[model samples]
Structure formats: C-alpha cells, structure tokens
Target: MGMEFVDLFNQWASSYDDTVAGKDPEYREVFEGYEEMLERLANLSKSPVMEFGVGTANLTRKMIEQNKVVLGVEPSSEMRRIAKVKCPEAAIYDGNFLEYPSLLTPIRSIISSFAFHHLTSDEKREALQKFREHLEDDGEVIFIDTLFKDEAHKQALIQDAEKQGFLNLARDLQEEYYPYLEDIKEIFVEEAFEVTFEQLNKYAWLIQARKGE
Candidate 1:
C-alpha cells in the first residue's frame, strides 16, 4: 500500500483499464495465442491461475470467462480494490512479488501483464524462482511487459515518466534486460521453462514460456 511504485499504481487503479485498454502495442497476437495456449497448458475451465500485478482486473476477467479460476495479486491496495470491483467473479489478493497470499492454494499457470517490469532485477529473479518452487511441475507463465534493450532506455523511461507525472507511472517504474530476450529467458530457464518473445509493436511485447509438462 505504501510502496512508492505500488502507491503510484494504486492511485491510478480506478481508471487503469481505460487508460491502457488500447494504448499498448504488446497486446497484438496475444489473445489468439493465449486462447490456444490455454487449452494446450491445461483445461481452461479447471486450471487455476494466479495473475501477478493484475491491475484493474482487465485481463483477469477475460481469462476467467474462459474458465480458469483466476486469482490476482497486486501490490497496490487501491488497485486491488478497484480490480475487485471490475472482476467480481475472480479472487484478487493484495501483495507484491516478494510475497504470496495465504488464500492462493495451488496454481498450474501464472500470468502477468505489464506488471513484472516494476520489480528490480533481483526481485525479478527471485520471483521466477518463487514460481518454480510453488508451481506444479508442468506449470507455465505468460508475461507481457515493456522491456528495455539497455540502461539508456531504462533511464530515458524514468526521465520521461517523471516529466509526465502519473501519466507515465507504468513506464517510469521499470527494470533492465540487456539483449532483453536473454534476460527474460534467464527468469524461467532454470525451471525447465522455455521462452518465446513477440515484439507486438515498439517498446512492448509478449513473453510466453512453458514449463516441462
């Protein structure tokens, strides 16, 4: 609730979806891929899912209709509360990547959208390990976010966002991934997960990985 990064998102939670609905370029080709991937991963109607940083419950609601019992985790209480209203049918938890909620039972799939980038590099690695430790042997992860090619981009992002204020919160809070592809790969490779990156548009893309099933 008090985290600077979290607080910023919480403050924007109420209008998060509308603010991001169509602005992002990473969303392309993801819906079709995910629709098919859901069946390939597990029974969408039966598989349980945990959405990290499920702000405003935009995608959470969409996934739930496909039948995966979705549980969302967001660090911002303001975001979580707003998400709850948007996704009344799904369960949402207030927590950061460093911790998990007691309510989360067991999940076969963990999904994140534009959320993972908020973490520091160390936190990102730890979170990947955390997922490996907690996920079922065959679990998979789907992440979509804005990745930086190098430090220059990272700094530019912060500066750009600072000038824009809350409007640039998502871009402002980000982590670095040199050769972005490999860095993302490291996040899940050890867990027997494979990476696939799709640059939907400029500065954004989708990373889909699957664990050994």
Candidate 2:
C-alpha cells in the first residue's frame, strides 16, 4: 500500500509544487502555516536539522535560508531530484526516516510535515525510537500532519466535509491514515518525550516533542 504512493508521488514529482498549491486556494493557506512553523523551528536551533519525507523541499528551502545545516530523507527519486533543484545545498538522501543511515549525530531537530501518516501506529513508534536514538539529548521531533482525536472525531470530520460539498475529499479521508492523537501521545509518553500540540485546523496539527531528561 505504501509502496503504491511512492510510485504515485514519483510520477507526480515534476509538477507537484504547482499542481498541489494551484488545485485549491485553501492549500496555499495551509502551506503558509506550514512554512511558518518550519521557520519558527529553524529560528529555535542553530544546530543540524533533518527533515523526513521532504517532498519537493518546501521547508528545506526555508531551513537553507536560516543557515542551518540541513539533511533531507526522501524516498522518491523524482522528489529528491526536485528537492535538489529547490535546495541544492541540502544533503538529500534516498530513503525514508526509518531506513535513514542516521550518520548525522547529535541532530538538534528532526521534523516532518504531512508525511508521518505513511507509517502505521506501530511503524510510527518504531520510527520515533530511531529518531530518539539519533537526536541529541535535548533534541526535538516536530510533526505537522493530519491528526484527529479518535475514530469518532474522524467520522465527524467526514460529515463536516460532506456538509461542505466535498464528498470526494471525504471519501479520500476515509481511506487516509491520519494518526490518532492519543496514540501518538502514548508513544511520546512511553518514549519519555515531552510533547506539545498546536491545532492547524479540524484535521491537521503541529506536534513538537523533546527527549526528556
């Protein structure tokens, strides 16, 4: 199932930046917030940073401007090609976060936007453990993605989408792997990571967590 998306995104990589933003005006607003969050994270740290699933290098470009030593882990070759064009100085690697070499030690911050859902709950926990190992003692992990409180909340979102005359979007939502909020919190707690969450919308949020002492 996940491999399917890799191929799909690879095919879409060429025109991804323009099409995704041009398809809807709302996406532009979401991307603005996404960029804002990345900029804030960049300002928070002067150390090395890593971005997981860096599609088209949207945030990578921002980190480059902040002068942070940035590395990007991207699964799709086509996407990495685009990311290179977008941020040539960034060290883009060909792998997912779970399989990343972890050669960069004491990484100050590891971040992902709208890409964490590619992992299942168990996979998410596994990836988080790997991220923790690669991070500095007080390093942070930030995720901005589709997040919901529970199944009921997800259903409510579907209903809201239908009310807005977006049945196709609702259908897509039903099949998506939006991470459950409490489940992610449990992983953070179990991993001894201090966590904070900021809601971006009814269906998306930004989560910032740090390894606890």
Candidate 3:
C-alpha cells in the first residue's frame, strides 16, 4: 500500500478535530482571512459552499457562519464517521468531491484542508481542471497544504520526525508531496488566479484562485 490514507485517518479521527483545528494553529488564523477573500472572489449575497476535503470538520467549523450551506466531502471513512460529531448539521458526504449536481449546491467557493496535497501531480492537474470546470466565472478555489523551502528543509523535517514515532511516515509523506507544488503554483499563475504564497507554520501554502472570466 502506498499509504493507507484510510488507516492513517482512522487512527487520528477521534482526536483529530481537537488536535489539528480546535487548537490554535496557523490554519485557524488563515480561517480569519477567508471572509475577506470571499469579498475578493465572489461577493455574493448567498452562495452555497463546498469543502472538498473536510477533515475532522476543521475549516468547516470556522466557515459555517459565512455560507448559507456548507457541504463537507471527505473520502476517509474514519474522518467521515467522526465529522458528524464535529458538525452534525452540516451535510457530510462519505466520498470524495462528487461531480453530481445534487451533491454540490451551486457553490461559490470550493475549499479543502491539507487534503489536496495528498494527490499526485497528474491528479493535482486533473483536480484543478475539474475545479475550474465546476466553478462559475467569479467563483474561487481555496487549497490549504504544505510547502517546504527546499530538499534540505524537507530532510530537516524528516530529521525532526526521527524523535517522533512517525519518522518514516513523515518521510514518506514528504516524498509524496514536495515535487509538484512549484508546478502547481505556475499553473495557478497561468490560470489568471492571483496566487500569493505564504508560510503557515510547517504546513504552508494557502492558495486562493478565482475563476477569471
């Protein structure tokens, strides 16, 4: 198995919500800026929203008040199972981002939390294309993930991981993610979506891309 995403999540699901989002992380601070970004993307009176990877109800808990309806889509069965506890009222889907119109209710913003990076480069491009096709001209896509400084920086993270039980896990994850981000950033720039790169602690890259008509 490349990485048992389901099993990894299953191990963390019960306490995942509290550890990742509930506590004060840079991501939580990033949430503070999203409403301002809503104004930049689509200043709509009412627009349905979707979270492609709503992990442990992290960002959803913050965004619930902004959008009329928040649809959370998570592929991890463990995450899906626990999401109900974090966000009982918000609609939860035990699947990945569904193209079905019934699943997405005319969304203005499609956002995810540390989830998009789990895909491969080809998957990233394909997913970005899908995001473009689904979004309206003015709609926006928000992707939150990690961006390392360089190979040495990544090695440093792996070195640090040695002290933790998940040293190999961290190494494997870094192997999976770091290569494609630069290419992805270029793609975003070419797509006419204003891209500003920022460091959100260890796990950075809060990308905001609006569909330009």
Candidate 4:
C-alpha cells in the first residue's frame, strides 16, 4: 500500500466506523446492511484465520466472538491502534494485503471486508497467490467488498453517483480499483481457486473462494 492510502486511512480511523454505520449519506448505500455483511463473513470463516486490512477490527471482533483464532494485518497505524483496542485478544499487525507478517499456523480461512478495493487488479492477484501459499489445503478466502458486475455496471454506478450530486462518491467510483466481477473470477480461476459470489447489497458482494483440488 502507498503512503497516501495509509495516511488516508489513518485520517479516516476516528470516524471510519461512523461512515460504515450510515452516518455518511453519500456512503450509506455502500454500507447498507453493514453489520449483517460482517456477521455473515464471520460465520463463513474458520479458525486460525488471517484478515487483511482489518480496519477498526469490526469483523475481527465478530470472529473473536465466535471463538475463531484471528491474526489481523492492517496498513495504517491508527487503524491498527483502534483495532487492537477493539479486539485485544486478536493479534493485529502492521501490514497490507500484498505484504504482511508471516503466520506460524496455517490459516484455515483468510478474510477481509470493505478494504480489498484499495488494491489494483494485479495487486489483488498477487495477494491471492500469497494467500494460497499460506492457507491450508481445504482453506477458503472470503471477502465482502464493492465489486461491479461488469465495466458497464461500474460506469452506470459512477453516473448515478454523479447524477445524485455526490461528487466525492462519484470520484471514489472513478478513482478506486473497484473491480469487475468477471475479472475477479478470472484471476481466481487462473490462480487455481474455485470462487463464488453472493450479492449482499447494491455495492457489496461476498466472495468465497477455495483452492481447486
């Protein structure tokens, strides 16, 4: 991750939870059913998990509540500080998706939420390859994030944001590496993973993938 994103997240650390809780009208739709999405992701995950971009530890808290052993990696120090306070039992480290501390145990489930879009398509692929290296043979990779059905769908969303006069949201849509569904699937397949997607809301999709036998 770049220093700009780290700084951006560091700045967002204090109010990031509020934004996800519907406090920001522009992003409310993006985070609608936020708790449900986190809960579902937690439920789908297995113990000895490694979570990338574990911002604020919201999902980490859920996993810990379920008695899952979790190791969280985050790029922003502020986010890590907040997450550590929120999820003291889980070991949260300083790292990004493509680079993180080594795990002692083979991770049974690798997970994340609302953070993968920070990575470009190639970065995402590299992260997936690294995940495959760390996961147990039958382990899964689960994430809930903003993903579009296709390029046209992504463009439509940007247009809608602009039409609604949400310049920030529109700019986010245009600037972020929010990926196309087909592209994500192709990367997973090429990386030898069988993947599936379930739409949780208009903006977020739950992606569950496992290594191909």
Candidate 5:
C-alpha cells in the first residue's frame, strides 16, 4: 500500500466501525452481515494467526474470543491505535499486506477481512507468496472481501450502484482492485494452494485457501 491509501484509511479510522455496522446508508448492503461474516472468518481460522489489514480489530476481537493468538498488521497508525484498544491481547503492528515485521515462528493461519481489495492482482499474488513463506506447511489463508464472480458480474454491480445514486459506492467499485473469482482461484492454484469460495452476502465472499500437502 502507498502513503495515499494510508492517509485515506487514517482519515476513515474513526468512523470505520460505524460504516461497517451499517450506519452508512450508501454502504449498508456492502457491509451487510458484518458481524456474521467476522464470526465465520474467525471460526475458520486457526490459532497463532497473522491478520493483514486488521482495521479496528473487529475480526481480531472475534479471533481472540475464540482463544486464538493473533498478530495484526495494519498500515494506518490510527487504525492500529483503535485496534490495540479493542484487542489488547493481540499484537497490532504498523504494516500493510505486502510488507510487515517477520514472524519468529510460522503461523497456523493467515487471515484478513474486507481489506484485501486494496491490492491489485499482481500485488495480491506477491502477498500470497509472502504468506506462503510465513505460514506453516499445513496452514490456511482465510479472507472475507468483495469479489466478483466474473467481469460481467463486476460490471453489473457498478451499474447497479450508479442506478441507486450511490455515486461513492460506484466510484469505489470502479477504483478498487477487487478481483474476479476465477482469477483469484487461478492465482491460488498457481501458488500450490487449494482454495474455495462462499458468498457471504451480495458484496462479500469468504475465501478459504489451504496450502497444498
């Protein structure tokens, strides 16, 4: 991530929780079932996990409630600050998906939520490679984010957002680096990971990928 994104997130940190909680009318559908999605992701993940883009530590809190050891990586200082207060048991660091402090031991799982779209396809692949390096041989990667079934599905969403007069949502859909399902599956396969996807809501999907034996 770049300084621009960091600044954007820094600015958003204060109200991110509210936005995700469906307080933002325009983004309500996008964040529908927010609590359920976090619970599902936390349940799927294993202990000694490393979570990227741990915004406000919502997911971190869930994992901690499950007695999972979590290391949170976040680029925004403000987000990290809030996350620390919310999830004091977890270690929250100042870093992005692609670059973070190295772990002394391989983690059992690598996880994230809603934040993976910040990276482009190439960057996603690069981050996956790094994740492979940091994970145990049998570790898994779990992420919940907005992903399209295909190019057409993505376009339809953008058009729908525009029709709803959700200009900000429409612009975000157009500007972000959200990936196609098939493309992400191919990338995971190429990296020797077995992956699966389940739609959690109209906008988000749960991706569960495991390292190949």
Candidate 6:
C-alpha cells in the first residue's frame, strides 16, 4: 500500500496543484480553510516547522513566503521535486512520517494536510508519539484530513458521492481507510496529548494536539 501510494502521488505530482484547484466545492473549501490555518500558524511563530507528506509543498510554500523556517518530509521523489521548485527555500526530506527520524529536534509545530489519512489507526498513534517525542516544549502537531466518527459516516459519504454521480470517487473513498474519532481521542488520552478536534464537515476535520507539560 505504501509503495503504491508513493507511485500514485509521484504520477500525480505534476498536476497535483492543478487538480486541487479543480476539486469540487466542498473539498476546495477544506483546502482553503487549511491554507488560512497554515498561514496563521506561520505568522504566529518564527520557530522551525515541518510538514509530513508534503506533496508539492502547497502549504509549505505559504510558510516559506512568510519567512518561516520549514522542512518538508515527502516519500515521493517526484512530489519532492515539485515541492523543491515550489518551496526552494525550505528543506525537503525523503521519508514518511511514521518511519522518518527527527530531522529537526524541538520543532515548534508539525503539520500535515490531506496526507495523514493514509495511515492506519495504529500507525496514527505511532506517528503521534513520534510527533510528541520531537516537539519543542510548547510544540503542537496539526492534522487536516478526512476524519469520520465511524464506518457508518464513511458509508454515508460514499452513498452521497454515488448519488451525485461520482461513482469512481465513491469507490475510491470506499477503498480508503479513515481513523475512528473515538479511537483517536482515546489514543490522545493514552499518549497524554491535549487534543482538539474541529470538524469541518462529515468527512473532513482538523486535529490540533499539544503534549502535556
């Protein structure tokens, strides 16, 4: 699955930004909101920032524009190439979140958009633990992805997509796995990370978590 996704994103790397611009209104809105949040976070701190699975470095470009120090961890070479062109000033690492070492210790904040849902629930927990281990004293990790309460909610999304005549998209959604809301919350509790979940819609959410002092 990992290698397949790497190949898929690599294939889509060139057209990734354009494809994002042409997405349906709902998904576009989520990206727009994510951009706003990324900008705000960049403006709020001058500390080092890292983006996991930064395909094309869309948000990382925004941070670079604000004069923030940024690092991008991307497993796809093609995606990393585009991201380098887009955010040449930022550092780019070749790896995924779960396996990547702490390239920058005491990072101010870790951010990922639309990429984290690729991880399974256990992987998510492991990734979060890694985030905590690499964070600064007051650091946080922000995730923006498709987060659902359970399988029922995901099924509803698939049904709605099919009803709207997006059969292929619905099928893709069916194949993708999303972390359960309750399970994520429980993991946060067990990890002692103070987490806040902001639901953007039935399918999208923003998770902001900070390690306890």
Summarize candidate 3's per-residue lDDT along 90-154 as a digit string, tens digits: 88786664332354345677777566666766666666677777677777887666666666776
Q: Write the per-residue lDDT of candidate 4 for residues 8-113, one digit (tens) a residue.
A: 8999999999999999999999999999899999999999899988999999999999999999999999999999988889999898898788789898999999
Superposed by TM-score, candidate 6 places the C-alpha of residue 79 at a distance from the truth, in angstroms, of 0.7
Alpha-carbon shift of residue 145 in model 6 (angstroms): 1.1
Residue pairs with backbone overlap in model 4 = none
Model 1 TM-score, 2 decimals: 0.73
Instruction: Report model 4's TM-score to 2 decimal places.
Output: 0.97
Model 4 poorest ten-residue lDDT run = 1-10
Q: Candidates' TM-scores?
A: 0.73, 0.88, 0.75, 0.97, 0.96, 0.88
Give the distance in Å from residue 141's predicted Cα in candidate 2 to where it truly belongs: 0.4
42-106 per-residue lDDT for model 1 (tens digits): 33223678888877776777787677788778888887787788789888877877786764476
- Candidate 6 per-residue C-alpha lDDT over 170-209 given as tens digits, one digit per residue, 9 for 90 to 100: 8767676567788888988788789889887455687888
lDDT of each: 0.64, 0.77, 0.62, 0.90, 0.90, 0.75
**2 or 5, greater by lDDT:** 5
Please write out the lDDT profile of model 5 over residues 38-109, one tens digit for every residue.
Answer: 988899899899999998999999999998888889999999999999988899988888888978888999
User: Cα deviation in Å at residue 154, candidate 2?
Assistant: 0.9
Superposition error at 106 for model 5 (Å): 1.2
Error of 1 at 98 (Å): 1.7
RMSD (Å) of each candidate, 1 decimal:
5.5, 2.4, 5.0, 1.1, 1.1, 2.5
Q: Could you give candidate 2's per-residue lDDT for residues 112-198 as a string of tens digits?
A: 777887777777888888888888988999878787788898888788777877775687577756777898889888888899888
Error of 1 at 127 (Å): 0.4
Question: What ranges in model 2 sit over 4 Å off?
Answer: 1-4, 19-22, 25-32, 163-168
